[model samples]
Target: MTTLPTLTLRDGLTMPQLGFGVFQVPDDQAQQAVESALEAGYRSIDTAMIYGNEHGVGRALAASGIAREDLFVTTKLWIDDHGRGAARPALEASLERLGLASVDLYLIHWPAPATDVYLQTWQGFEDLRAAGLTRGIGVSNFLPEHLDRVVGLGGAVPAVNQIELHPALQNRETVAANAALGIATEAWSPLAQGAVLGEAPVVEAAAAHGVSAAQVVLRWHLQHGNIVIPKSVTPARIAANLDVLDFTLSEAEMAAIDALDRGQRTGPHPAEFNG
Candidate 1:
């Protein structure tokens, strides 16, 4: 079994650097997919209320019989639940769906900057953390300016910032900004939804490493110090994704992939996305 490396958050909590993501996974299939991931040695599971699969994920966790302490579960507060008053109830509803006493981390799903309530939402996150509803709190799809505001005025620095990052869309500036603030940078779409795998540079690196292009890209994420959550419902792919820890990407190979960035994004822009 491959043991994934853990990244310690600014709050001192540890998370598996390579984990499983359940985005776009249907509610009925989430349980089985998550079970496969857990069986493949993935200890961290990322989900969101918007995904509408929390109950299924919780079912898988309950059925796996895995010790609660050994698993790291993360769920996000949806865009509809952005206000300070709505935060706790939203999290509580997620907890109910997840059938867990508390999640490992809770993140604001998006900055929804146009709404102008993320600061209040951040405060709610802080309050939840203090109340023990979540071991740690963070934000997702948040730009540097959003992070700056939340940290500067919200009275707490986020422990993590989950964003869409891949070889083709490195978002280096956001990653650097998070690094400067001691926030863990987490890559949500680390493979670019299969875009990077077909890139010439990625293919060459995979051939040289005797690994799959997916592995090459995932390894690149690890080498670059970004926590990655690659989504796959296929058992073989799920297992293969976790196998990235075995190979090391050379400096030249890393740079070649870095050059592939064309600023393409598969997800919505943080600053402009109100939902």
Candidate 2:
């Protein structure tokens, strides 16, 4: 088994750089999928309330028989629950659903700047951390300005910022901003929802390396120091995704993938997505 590298958070905690995500996975399949991922040596699992499968994730965790301290579980607060008063209860509900006393990390799913309540919600995150409900707290889909507001006014720096990134949508600005603030950049749609698998650059690299296009793309992300969560329910893919730790992409190959970025996005823009 490949030992996945871990990234240290600003708060001194470490998280597995390569993890599994349950984004569009249905409730009926999430448990078996996550159990397979765990069996494949994934220590970190990312889930969200909006994904509507936390319960299944919880069931898998409970049944895995893995020690709680050895796993890193992350769940997010949804857009509908974007206020100071609403955040804690939402987290508590998530805890109950996850069957855990506390989570490894808690993230505000989106900035939802349109609502102008992220700062207040961030304060609630701070309160949760202080009260020991979560080991660490962070944000997702937050732009630099949104992060500035939280760090500047709310006074709590996020440990990580989860975003949609891939070879086609590198999101350099956001990644750089996260680096500047010492926040780890986590890539959610690391393969662009399978949009990048057949691209000429990825295919050529995959053939040259004798690996799958998905492995090449995932290796690109790993070499770039971006935390990636590629989700798949297929047992082979679930195991193969973690196989990226073995290979390395050259600088030229890295640059080729970099050139593939055309500002394309598979999901909503942080500045525009209110929900």
Off by over 4 Å in 2: none
Error of 1 at 84 (Å): 1.0
Displacement of the residue 219 alpha carbon in candidate 1, Å = 0.1
In candidate 2, what are the lDDT values of residues 1-275, reduced to their tens digit? 67889999999999999999999999889999999999999999999999999999999999999999999999999999988889999999999999999999999999987889999999999999998999999999999899888889737799999999998898888899999999999999999999999988899889888899999999999898999999999999999999987678888888888999999999999999997
TM-score of candidate 2 versus the correct structure, residues matched by position: 0.98
- Candidate 2: minimum summed lDDT over ten consecutive residues — where? 147-156
Candidate 1, lDDT over the whole model: 0.93
- lDDT for model 2 comes to 0.93
Candidate 1, residues 72-104, lDDT tens digits: the string is: 999999889998889999999999999999999
List per-prediction Cα lDDT, in the order shown: 0.93, 0.93
